[model samples]
Target chain A: MGIIDKVRKVSETVWEIPVTYKEGMRAPARIIATEKLVREITAVMDFQSAASRQWMWA
Target chain B: MDVGVGGVISPGGIGFDINCGMRLVITNLTSDDVRPYLKEIVDLLFQRVPAGVGSHGFLKISRQEFREVVEQGARWCVEHDYGWEEDLELTEESGCISGADAAKISERAIDRGYNQIGTLGGGNHYLEVQVARPEDVRDKELAAKFGITIPNQIVVMFHCGSRGFGHQVATDYLQIFLKVMESKYGIKVLDRELACAPFESPEGRDYFAAMKCGLNMSFANRQVILHRIREVFSEVFGRSAEDLGMRMIYDVAHNTAKLEKHTVDGKEKRLLVHRKGATRAFGPGQEEVAAPYRDIGQPVIIGGSMETGSYLLVGTSSGDQTFFSTAHGSGRTMSRTKARKLWHGKQLQRDLEARGIYIRSTSWAGLAEEAGAAYKDIDEVIEATELAGISKPVVRFTPIGNVKG
Candidate 1:
């Protein structure tokens, strides 16, 4: 799934990926960004890979 | 953004040279005092202050003396009569940043810096004369409070930095940081150019120290140029610089890493602030600001490309949101090669002269790259900063005569 799909929408510009959603996350992923930024972030798979790597620790 | 150190250097961060920068000096002179002999004043300044690549100043000192320049910064120049003792008080970090170890500087770096002091080194560096707006004249009461309007009514501005020495230092560290990042830190890379060692690592510390030396070197270099500019003014106008009110208002560094305390959450935290192509916009009441300006905010000098207008801004409290930072220049829109292909130096010079903007430079290629068309509209950038609540504009300055390096 795309990273955006995994994130819980908080506001038009903000999103939250709860710590419990990841396996080994040290902290929840809170993105203070615009809709455009969210779209841009999800377009890159590398962020998903990195996010998954951090999830391993959770 | 979380990848940490993206592959391509952000022109916003790396700039031309990692630390290429500028300093601003507020003079006490009025426009009238400078008008009668503006041509002669510019000529004298051009002769005294070396321009172009590989340019050297009148001062010749030993390696040991040069080391002192790197370590002591503008203090070294003040001791040698290049600047006044009070001048240091107005400079960032009092014109000196600690941890500069001359021994760490490479031979080539030293060679490049040896004679370049006091020079207006080539590419983007320039000396400008400007006047405050008419509104400021009506608000003399307010202007006097901030030392904004001077007696002679003209502000002398210059943009330059450590020159070749700084470039070499950045080059040296980039190589070392790259090797250390891989061999010792186990950091797998993206772009080789974004090479870095951990902030607290040994290699990182070494680079920081060397960068301080670069910072100090530029301070001393500018300090010396200030003296030369004073001499030129005195000789051309037949009046001492002091009589012409050539007092320094303030000087600030554009590129450098600094350690500062700021509110991170609810409490204050100290963080290493790296401002590459950004200038610090410390708000009023901050202890770091000079006492005279403490109530009014730190002066933010934004130099435009030679063909455009420059601006004087003030740091707003809201800037704390962005780590007290703002954009440095117009930001280049074209590479040097592309600019040269599009514009001819002589034609550009003629065009500027027609517009009543005088320009003097050593290289045609340098002039072309600095064409106003080669950069973003400075007014728009400043406007964006204001809209973003990053900075507040105080006054706008249009250049009369320019000495390009």
Candidate 2:
């Protein structure tokens, strides 16, 4: 499922992904962003996380 | 979300450039007064403030003094006559986060940081001269209160950080954290970069103290840069910085994790807020808000890409939802590499100069990478922040001169 589908809107600008989305999750991840910014922030975050993984074990 | 005393501290959370931040200085000169010397001013600033990769500063201090600088922060700069005493009053945390231990910083970090004070690093970092147009005043009362008086009032804004010193600090800690995160703490993560140690753990505490040194180093760096700016302007205008009304509006850090008191579940809790790519927008009446702005709110300087413009905003009482935080800047929508490929630095410089914005940079590649088009619409970002009630825009600053790194 997509991140937007996983996150439940908390407010007009805030979104939260429940801990149940992934195993070993301690708490929900709260993001403060507009609908448009969500795309930008998530895209960069995904790229960074993937690159971080490669750097970590390389 | 109570980190309480047992929260985990992630070096990744704060990023590599420990206290990458912004500082805005207001001046009494109007745009017309500065327009005549815009090129000269930008040229002198480009000369005085070292920029680009591996840039060293003019400050000459031994290892012992550098140790004291990290420990004392901007206060050391003030004591040494680099800035006015009032500058600290307007700075967040009085320009120094307490509990920074010099000994916590590695020698490698010291070697990198010792001479980097007052230097601007490359990649989206810049020293800009902006004008607060009369038409751009959103809140006239608040704008006047923040020192942006008169039409087309000139102000200097710069974005920089702890330089190589902070990078070394992060590198040193990231290596240590990676080793102990899983073996010592048994804390596994989705990504290895999420490596963290308990707040009270020896590694965590040491990193926290070391990070504060990075914070202080950045603060001191900006303070000295301000000093250079004041000198450059004084020479060009033949007036003292004070006589020219060069008062600092505020200085804020973008990458940091701080232990702060907040209301969670209607109960007071100490949370370790990791504000990466975010800024603290403490509301009015918060004790942490500077005294001059206590009746209003903390001045949040949202720096836009040099091509467009930036904004001066005030925190809102309604900012409690996201732990009283807001976006740091019009974040990059395009990668630096992608941007460099799309635009040439020299061409971009000529394009900006044609649009009435003076520009100078160490490299055209760096300049092109920071082309305004590469970032999100700053107006839209500010609108989002205001609509979300995190911060209220007071005035917008249009750049007339910029020294890009």
Candidate 3:
């Protein structure tokens, strides 16, 4: 499954993927976006792999 | 998200352009007052403010002075008469983060950025003139406090960053981190761009100090640009910026990681907040907020595509859920390459002009890349942030004039 598939809705405008989704992740990754935004964001380019990787916990 | 004090510091988290930010300036003039000269104002601004890729600033300063510029940030600009002293207070971190150390910067970075102040770089960077219609004010009292009292009030907003200097800083440190991440630090990363060092490590501390230089440089750049904007308005309207009521609303950086104290599980601890494509949105009564806005909240400027409009928002106490951070802009829905293929810049310009927006661009291709359809709906993003209680909208500003880099 893609990163988007693993993303769980945390709030009306927030979504998250736990550390289990990707190895080496120190903490869960969160996105502050609406459902529409989340869909659009994840479907575009390499956001699921490359760009989303950059969004990992610092 | 809170990267606790003991957490790592990733240069990638801050992005290439350190301290990329938005600045809003409110003017006493109304849309009616500026309508007659919209084209003239945009043309003059385009000519005066350097824009586009590799654009050099008009200012001539020695390398030593450039070091001071990066270290002191906007304060250096005000000291050199490029801005008003009061402009500093309205800026984030009073326009100068205290920890910036020019000594930590690479010589190569210095060479790239020393002459880049007062410039708007290419790729989605722009200077726009907007107006706040009476109906656009979501909160009349709040909007009035932000200098949007009169109907159709004119305001100037711009988005840019530390230019090449910031990029070089990130590049320099990324390479160093790559060398040390696995070998010396025993840290593994998925991508090279994700290279990082421990926050307490020497390499990380050095990068942090160097990054501050880039942060300060961006503030200085915006300060100088604001000065030029004031000059252009004065020249065109035949009145001083002060007489024209051209005062700054606020300057907020969207990128950069900083150490901040926050309560987690009922204990206050320092967390290194890394806000990439996100903005700090401290709510009311925050001591870090400017004195004038401390009672209300820090002003947040959200830039939309040139074709659509932008927003003036304020932070909310409820933003603590995300460490007091909010979305930076209408995140792109389509890639620049795809957008360029979809829109013709010349035709887009004409269409926008017919709708009462005047635009000047450095390149047609660049202009096409920033087409409104290229980005997600800004109104939707604002509504989401509002529903999430991260930020509260004060007013919306429609673009009347724009200079795209």
lDDT of 1 by residue, B267-355 (tens): 67666676776788898899998777788788778888777777777788988767798777776666677899999988998998788
Q: Please give the DockQ score of every candidate, comma-separated.
A: 0.06, 0.27, 0.59
lDDT of candidate 2 over B166-253, digit per residue (tens): 9998889989999998899888887766778898889999999999999999999999999999999999999988899999999998
DockQ of 2: 0.27
lDDT of 2 at A30: 71
CAPRI quality band, candidate 2: acceptable
* Model 3 ranges with Cα > 4 A deviation: A1-4, A45-48, A51-58, B1-5
Runs of candidate 2 exceeding 4 Å displacement: A5-7, A18-25, A42-58
The residue-by-residue lDDT of candidate 2 on A1-58, one tens digit each, is 3556776887777777677765656667776667787666666555553433222110
DockQ, candidate 1, comes to 0.06
For candidate 1, the lDDT comes to 0.72
Full ranking by DockQ: 3, 2, 1
Worst 10 residues of 1 chain B by lDDT: B1-10
Candidate closer to the true structure by DockQ (higher is better), 2 or 3: 3
Error of 3 at B153 (Å): 0.4
lDDT of 3 by residue, B1-405 (tens): 344544788888899999999999999999999999999999999988899989999888888999999999999999999999999999999999988999999899999998889999999899999999988999999988887899899999999999999999999999999999999989887778888888888998999899999999999999999999999999999999999999999999977999899999999988888888889999999999988999999999999999899999999999899899988889788888888999999999999999999999999999999999998999998998999999999999999999999
Backbone clash numbers for all candidates listed:
11, 0, 0
| TM-score to true structure, per model | 0.82, 0.95, 0.96
